[model samples]
Target: MTETEVLAVAGQQAIWACLMVGGPLLGLLLAVGVVVAILQALTQVQEAALAFVPKMVVLGLALMFGGPMAMSVLRTFTEDIFAQMVSVGGLR
Candidate 1:
């Protein structure tokens, strides 16, 4: 591929990798936040901790469980970049 085409492909792959790594966590947080908001609205308990605690707990749990998958995505991206570099004569 030409240099520009290669760069475009790399950028697309990078974006895809980022979404794969972050999408689940963000989606979970969105769902949790919405539920918490609805609950807070219904019960009329507007404590700052109420909103923050669940997100934090969920984020921690997600990281613990999702770290391996995130790492795998990153590793694969790094390998693809290196392989592309070799193919494009940018690496020995």
Candidate 2:
């Protein structure tokens, strides 16, 4: 495979990695936000800061749960890119 092919593969892999890593956390954040909004509406408590803590906590937990997988994906991508780079001619 040529350098361009390697790079294209790596780029696509990176994009996929990002989506895989980020999707859950983003989805959770959205869910939390919606729930908080609904609660605020029902209770009529317009405290802006109320949403902050729960979202942060949920997002943090999501990241903690997902962190290992994310790191593994990133490591694999980095290793692949490096292997390709070595095969393609040692950093040009």
Candidate 3:
């Protein structure tokens, strides 16, 4: 592939990787925020901690569990990019 074409593909792959890695954690935070907002409305609890704690806990867990998989994906991407760089004469 031409260098421009290869770079475009690599850029697309990196964007996809970001979405996959962040989608779960962002989804969890969204769900938790909605729940916390509803609960606050029902009980008039205005404490920021109430809204913050669950999202933090759940997102932390998501990262803890998915961190390895995310790292693996990223590492593989890096290796591929470097390989391509060498192939395209960008690296020696």
Candidate 4:
């Protein structure tokens, strides 16, 4: 493929990789926040920070669990881009 086509493909792949890596954790955090908010509303707790801790915990755990996979995905993308650049003589 031409340089432009290769770069476009790489850009798309990077975006897809980010989505794949982050989508599930973000979705889980959203679900938890919504559920917690509904429960707080029903109970009339109305604590502004009530959802914060749980969301933080859940997001932290998600990151911890998914860190390796996310790193691998990012590293692969970086390596691919570098390889393409080298192939195109963009890098010495």
Candidate 4 lDDT by residue in tens digits, 15-90: 9898989898989999999999899989999887897989999999999989899999889988988888888776
What are the per-residue Cα lDDT tens digits for candidate 3 across 1-92?
99899899889988988888888779889998999999999999899889888988998898899899989988988998888888888644
- Name the better of 1 and 4 by TM-score: 1
Ranking by TM-score: 1, 3, 4, 2
Task: Give the alpha-carbon lDDT of every model.
Answer: 0.96, 0.90, 0.88, 0.89
The model with the greater lDDT, 2 or 3, is 2
Residue ranges of candidate 2 with Cα displaced over 4 Å: 90-92
List CA RMSD, all candidates: 1.1, 1.7, 1.4, 1.4
Model 1, runs deviating above 4 Å? 90-92
Report the lDDT of model 4 for residue 14: 85
lDDT of 3 at 55: 89
Superposed model 3: Cα runs more than 4 Å off: none
- TM, every model: 0.94, 0.89, 0.91, 0.90
Q: Write the per-residue lDDT of candidate 2 for residues 1-92, one digit (tens) a residue.
A: 88899889888988998898888889999999999999999999999899899999998888888899989988988898889889888766
Any residue pairs clashing in model 3, and if so which? none
Quote the lDDT for 87 in model 1.
84
Give me the candidate number with maximum lDDT. Answer: 1
* lDDT per residue (tens digit) for residues 10-61 in model 1: 9999999999999999999999999999999999999999999999999999
